[model samples]
Target chain A: MRRRRLVAGLLLGLLLGSSQAFACASCGSGGDDPLILYPNEVDKIYVGVARATAFKNVDADGRFSTSGGPTVKDTLTLAYGHGFSPRAFVTGTLPWLRNSRQEATQTSLGDPSLAARYALVMASMAEPLIPQVQMLVGYKQSMTHSIHDSADLKTELDVFGTGFSEAKLGVDIWFGQLDWLAGAAFNLIKPLPHTYDGLRYEPGLASRSTLTAGYVFSTACKTTFGANLLARGSLRGDGVVQADSEQLNHSAFLTQDWLISPVESWRLSLSRQAAFGANKNTARSDGVSLAYLRSW
Target chain B: MQYLLRLSLCVFLCQACSTHSKADAPAVMPASTEGVASKNGTFFLKMDWTTGPKSAATSAATLSFYDANHHQAISVDSVAVVPWMTTMGHGTAMKDQKIVPVAGQVGHFTIDGIYLIMGGPWDIRVTATVNGSVDTATVAVTAP
Candidate 1:
């Protein structure tokens, strides 16, 4: 009798706890919502785990290396709605790893972001072409503590600064079973005056554009395969002069997904980036992951 | 005495009436083989069931395949069922029901050859046991 009562109480508590956490009264956006990094794409919710490793070399001989060295990151993304409803839903990516690189003297947890996306145009059934437009805005705050004894390297590098704010505008087009999506994003690093000679220094902003093609082969099995090409470039600046300055940045990635079950999936992805023009550098990374998802 | 006699007659008549109704009633429809399709050298066995009005009581269906020459059966452990609604535009629900290793009263099973790596003529058996009543059917499929 006692054990039965205890079990019942525990089950009741769990039920109530989840209901409270996932339920919202007025539909005001909450933290539990899915995060959207890509804009104007398919109408599907993705909840899965992913781990990625990035390797980068500033100079050919490894003068400066920004390899996160097998840093594990998981993502939860949600995309919903058929066509142009002003209200498209999104929110949820929290980075759990502290990014460390050989170039940086000290290491700490990198900035994570929270963002929301809204669709501008909806797909129409009459027309064969379905073009979707959307925007995403996110902010990442830096929380790394300085390792330098004094504010000595403050002017040299913007250490212990408030990180970056980003915005992306994108469009997605669908033709039959194939989906094509492209987007451009801008990242602005906030000026840090306290660390940089009390002179607010704004690092060159980073800009990126992406093109993705995906196909739904078996709708019943919910299996999808796609390839994505991402091009990232840094805006050139007139003031900064370092040993090796970056002028162009480019990267491409390919991804495949198998829906093992409705609530579970396995994914594989690979990417390579090359830096050229005024800047000469190259990097490559590959990763595979499996995740289980449950929705209320 | 007359009242007792009428009550006995009513009981006998009820038994006789139920016997005929039971005879006319449908025998639990046996499970059937619908289609066998192959993709990338692996065969997919599709099974259909006549799930009378009682959907909950129907536990689960099993598919078993046996080798022709050896007469030995090998169970395909990774059988999955994807539920699709006939309603247009309705999203399909896919579920994975891997066979649990357990002993059962009915040893017979249903098997499809599409999931086999090397395919040829194979004996297929399907069993749908519900509430102690076991209904089974078998078919042979040639995989190319």
Candidate 2:
């Protein structure tokens, strides 16, 4: 048993130490910022730095184009939340992202998102293993036109935000009786009003949906170690640069979480993802992120 | 040890499901005043201005091409745009007109910096080669 534990630890450790960037057009290097998406639970706070390396751009051909080199991104996030009642809670994050696309780099405050969640349906005595379902409703605003955003940006990787405002809704499920959880989410985003150099434009997305699953690991110190999978993308939307309605890149992400026990609030996570299967927008990428959290 | 095995199984199964997404055939973009026109029964062309067709002063337009069966042509080696006034008999004279692909948006190329020099009945000659197939088409732009 101890031998099996050592081998598994080594494999997951090896995975946590590397990177990839699977991206789409709207949020590739710049505007399509897939930077920070995690928040601690109610009444807790988390602050961390995250870095992403992106390269091998997917061209319109649906193939990886060699024209541009890898871009790297660093993000800082402050996460907070509160429980108003037994059934209601709110969680949010404000972030800043620095994007580097080859030789050019730009730093800007990223679009912030706020989510209000409610325990919609509780697990019943008849089916305790089914778990309770919670619903989350949220909004995200694009910060691309902020003062820190550069008008002369070179590539999508340099965009700190998508320049679009989005409405998000989703469900969260916790399998308290079991060892795993599953759920889904949806978002509708629209380009915020933007005008530059006497030109006006609006960003748009048909919609985006994400499906998620996570498994829990039990440790002697009460430490938590596990892996999470999230598959997400914009289903239909026009990039800020295009007049035609287009599909953004679709991506699947796998994240590993490790929390130190006795101090369970102290946590670290590593993630990797790939983007593919797009029209108008061609993207093939692999990316990894590492982050630490402080929770109360 | 049991937890480790479970974690390994989860990773193995999830990795198998994370393949790059694929979509259907090329979708038709919104039309410009100059709509889609078929050339030689096997290819189709659409003229659109990134700044809207009315922004003739900007001359930032996208020319999109697809096959007869509606498969979008992508990753072409080169795209050349020749701006000629059918009546005036001269190119834009602006030698730096750029015909480049619109990044991420497949089958679309942008034509920028085409100063018409004069607002007249102009023919924009577009020639593109994708996977050894050369496609050329001409469209008329009424300069603003």
Candidate 3:
């Protein structure tokens, strides 16, 4: 009888210690627990680092070979997500970047992004098999100068940001069974026109789409596979349109997520981008990223 | 929770304090005094700066062409100086700098308004029209 009482006391203690873990405010009970889109009541903070190396340049004709050596870029980011309501959240991210190729290397602070997301529909309440839909709006502000010396052959490599501020409108849909999940996200990115250093330039519109599929290995672990497509329009510099600047690229990626506790998780991703099928003026690269997130 | 927070803070601080080492971040390659031979080996090009490169600032440089033996100066019809960042694979803006032939000086040209734009290694590409043919040579320099 004493041993039974001791076990009961321990169970009660655990329940009291991690009440926020099992009870997400959005889902009254534990019914809407998806692998990737975990709607929780707590705020989240994330730190991530990514590295990408470009080994070849895709020419205008879509040929996947170039004469130069590899170029590597590293990015370290800190992000925060704040949930103001049960179905709405806002996020912000700041990044530091470094780029190196051959004998030249540079490091600088990159752009910061702010975004807000709202869940239009929750799948569990309406229909368990249906997908949850979320809408997002975001803006990325350029923090670096847009100036470049045209006489320097590699001037573009030294600059930090894309040289233009961009706005994003996007949507995400996620659906899953008990052990498998699928998701799709699409974002339209529009860069604003800004004049710098006596030159007026406006970048064209761009779009990114990603489709993801995941399998739950256990209650605490999951693995995901995804494909991404990015398309960009022509850029106009000083009232002159550069038609050859448009790009279309595709990449495939794999990721693994491990939930260490109710309030902490870790994720690792690997990706390979190829220059094929209408790709133009872009580099073929491989990338890897690791992230750690904590909630409170 | 307190321990986790402390751990996160420690990780961030350690990462932020780290920097690239010399082996990883190579030093700039200065231009060679021996000069670079053109692609066809018909002429050689040497670059000398009156005012060297400064980050985000304009500077000036001179280009002189020589024969294959690197001893005799050879004159060309026209010279165009293109400053390139080879790593980033783009050229600097022309700005107000135009390649001008030095008066009464054979095989010599001057370029002004040469902006490096950033602190890194840059390639100065010289394209000259010699004997109805284009001969190109490139020299590398670093901007402060």
Q: Per-candidate interface C-alpha RMSD?
A: 28.7, 15.9, 10.3
* Residue A213 displacement (Å), model 3: 1.1
Candidate 3 regions with alpha-carbon error over 4 angstroms: A1-37, A65-70, A102-104, A145-157, B1-90, B93-144
Residue A21 accuracy (lDDT) in model 2: 10
* Chain B structural similarity as TM-score, candidate 2: 0.67
Output DockQ, candidate 1. 0.00
CA lDDT of each candidate? 0.34, 0.49, 0.66
DockQ value for model 2: 0.01
Instruction: Give all candidate RMSDs, comma-separated.
Output: 30.4, 24.4, 21.6
Q: In model 2, which runs have C-alpha deviations exceeding 4 angstroms? A: A1-42, A59-61, A66-70, A102-104, A123-127, A146-150, A155-158, A174-176, A187-205, A219-244, A261-263, A266-282, B1-144
Clashes (backbone N, CA, C under 3 Å), per candidate, total 15, 24, 17
Q: How large an RMSD does model 3 have?
A: 21.6
Q: If scored against the real structure, what TM-score would every candidate get?
A: 0.40, 0.51, 0.62
Supply candidate 2's per-residue lDDT for A217: 51
Q: Which docking band does candidate 3 fall into?
A: incorrect
Per-residue accuracy of model 1 over B1-144 as CA lDDT, tens digit each? 999999999999999999877655432222453444322213333343322111112224444332222323323433333221111001111122234433331223432212311112223343433333333333443222
Q: Write the per-residue lDDT of candidate 3 for residues B29-78, one digit (tens) a residue.
A: 23445688888877788778888676456788888787766345777888
TM-score: model 2 vs. ground truth: 0.51
Per-residue alpha-carbon lDDT of candidate 3 for residues A139-191, written as tens digits (9 for 90 to 100): 88988643342223333455566678889888877664435767777889898
